[model samples]
Target: MAKIRITQVKSGIDRPERQKLTLKALGLNKMHATKEVEATPQILGMVRKVEHLVTVVEVK
Candidate 1:
């Protein structure tokens, strides 16, 4: 499986509960925090949910 890097570029403050939780689930609770994760369907869905709050980059 290919890996991707997820970075929390925006703050979760004032966001919905679900978004905040998604951020946490992505191992991102702070701004600029980055987590390398597999590009699975489930994880991709989660990332899509909070796409506005994060940035995704392919991991070489």
Candidate 2:
């Protein structure tokens, strides 16, 4: 599987609980925090849910 990097670029404060939880599921707990994970369908779905709150980059 390919790998990708997810970085929490914005604060989760004031966001919906579902989005916040999605961020947590993506291993993002704070602003600017990053996690490298497999680019699986599930992970990609979760990223879509919080796309506005994070930045994603494909890992070479």
Candidate 3:
């Protein structure tokens, strides 16, 4: 399976609870934190939810 690097570029201080949970669901915590996860439909959905707070990069 391939991996994707998800980097948190913005703060979640004032974000909605749903979006905050989405970040946690993506394995991200705190600003500038990054996590590598498999490219899956669920991940894509989460990314789309909080796209403003993160940057996604393809990783092998």
Model 3 regions more than 4 Å off: none
- How do the residues 1-59 of candidate 1 rate in per-residue lDDT, one tens digit apiece? 99999999999999999999999999998899999999999999999999999999999
What TM-score should be assigned to candidate 3?
A: 0.92
lDDT of every model, 2 decimals: 0.96, 0.96, 0.92
Clashing pairs in 2: none
TM-score of candidate 1 relative to the true fold: 0.97
TM-score of each: 0.97, 0.98, 0.92
- Using TM-score as the measure, what is the rank order of every candidate, best first? 2, 1, 3
Weakest lDDT window of 10 consecutive positions for candidate 1:
21-30
lDDT of 2 by residue, 1-60 (tens): 999999999999999999999999899999999999999999999999999999999999
Model 3 steric clash total: 0
Name the TM-score of candidate 2. Answer: 0.98
